[model samples]
Target: MSDNVYIAVHGGAGFHERKYEKEIKHALQRACNVALSNLGSKHSSALTMVEDAISSLEDDEHLNAGYGSNLTLDGTVECDAAIMSGKSGCFGSVGAVAGVKNPIRLARAVLDHSSIPSPIGRIPPLTLVSEGARQFALSQPSSAHLVSRESLVSPQAEERWRVWKCRFASSDPSSLSGNLNDIQDTVGAVAWHESDGMAAGVSSGGLLLKYPGRIGEAAVFGAGCWAQEASDVEQGMEMACSISGTGEYIIRAMLARRLGEAFEKGAGNSDGDDPHEVLHGVLNDQFWNMRRGRGEPDPSVGVLLLTRENDGRARLWCAFTTPTMAIAYVSSKNPKAKAIILRRPQNITLGDDKPCIYITGISL
Candidate 1:
């Protein structure tokens, strides 16, 4: 199969410049690189990026997500995640999975195997079954396997592993000791894998205090992530990207999605499928503040744009934020630059209209 282009994203949303220490920034960068490396070796599928990002969030204790996800009034870390495809429009999602690192990937698997995709015309797409889907998850390498819920006990290194398994494996929640209220964070990933082997994926993790009620877009399809024609997303009747930013972070990330929609509509349809050129127009486009929120200054979103091609093209774009600063990364056809790096957007524009990702119907 030809190596086609594919891209995915995980938006952290708003960030505070002073909040992230050098170590923190470096850690985030390393996670991005790890995500790509995992994908390249096929050790981790496109969906694995979702797990990679959330794992970092848990380790960092930032962005009100992952292990650090915000706490509810009662204090608990109930989480949610969603994954979708820009290609087949298939989506899968799960909410409140405790002890699981990559909720988004599981959701993507649901979409990949369970749902019946919308008809693509005279030709109809076959659907996947749950049994096969379960096998797919089991097939991953140890690094990609669903780490047992016991992995996060926060105990001495010698006994941490055994303790975690003991706590999480129990049939009764009562058996688990320390703070049963708050769990870890929620995670999700999106990707498009073609019959020819091209694919894309995205992920996000949020929530800290083990709060149960705070549900963000990452747990829902079309709201957080999307993709197309690559593999399984086409059935949803819409292809879109994933959302990793928090409530505030999500609102800010809108700017980037606005740009993507513009590209889809024709902001920069040059002679070829050069995504780099597409970014030139998408990132630079100017727009007014959109979707009024409770806060002033009208918020928006950022992006990490990626593109690739052997014969066909695949793109992965990630957007994230915190109170300190926003981060974006891109990966694509250029094998030399498989690593994800931060970018300074020269023209950060806000949209007055609410940030939205539109999924075209199969009929369209």
Candidate 2:
């Protein structure tokens, strides 16, 4: 086993309310602890840790992912999830899926299914959607993961949906403005293990009142999550990233994979190999600027990234354009997970030419 193993998770990049701060932090810390607890098992790897951690997050009703996800236009619960392995470059996802207790487990099953040799030379699917995804889940050995669609909906989510749906029908422009506390904050995780290198995964309940069958970045390859090793071992860094924000903009930019590429290419500007600069450059040039040019006044995104250098140093980085982002981290060296709700300072003025982005790094 590798001497160092680490896992980090994010609740989402959105306006996390001060009233629910304790519950949000506890949820993130619980996931970190659940992931790290498997360290004693001989079979544990980065992939499993990522899966385990996200499954825990999905079960929580407070965040928007699994059980307490947002409702569709017709008031049905649908979810999107994806997982990727840096070691093998394997990817799997499910989109607009319902009736699954844990969507991340289904995604991992898809990744595992892709490895089987096919006798008829038929290509396996990287993603499955709607009823097809549910059928595929039923075909898996653990059919117990499937549940009644209504059973997955929490009382709190149903109430939120009812209130929003009424407001939506009234044709109130304020409805379109959206409540900060009720935004679609997709949850995700990134991890690195001595033996398996790195892996990342993301899950989302999607936007409230969205049309049925709508898919978000969480279901798209290279958009929601990315994990990869450095091509040039001596000079480069192995990295994995999980992203949360507006799905359309994130999908167009392929934000997660873009960040991985930036790290692999080294800092191209005068910043001189600073990861912080690379993050700012990508968020500004690729995401923020592009969105603004297209007439988008506000674009939200939050990223949780894990990096390991050739010299055996590892760090966790969080960057977001939203008001606040909740995250937690734990490693073998420090078993106790630390959770924090990072809020952008209100005193910081946003300029017309500048993107409202905050970046911070934590040593693991």
Return the TM-score for each candidate structure. 0.52, 0.96
Q: Report residue 230 deviation for candidate 1 (angstroms).
A: 9.6
- Model 2 over residues 128-175: C-alpha lDDT tens digits? 999999999889884329889998788988988888888888978676
Kindly state the number of residue pairs that clash in model 2: 0
- Candidate lDDT scores, in order, read 0.39, 0.89
Q: List residue ranges in candidate 1 displaced over 4 A.
A: 1-11, 17-19, 39-45, 48-64, 115-211, 230-240, 244-263, 267-290, 293-300, 303-364
Model 1 Cα displacement at 327 (Å)?
Answer: 3.8
Tens digit per residue, CA lDDT, model 1, 51-116: 455445444443333444443333333345554434344556555554444444555555555444
- Judged by whole-model lDDT over C-alpha atoms, candidate 1 comes out at 0.39
Position 178, candidate 1: lDDT: 51
Worst 10 residues of 1 by lDDT: 355-364
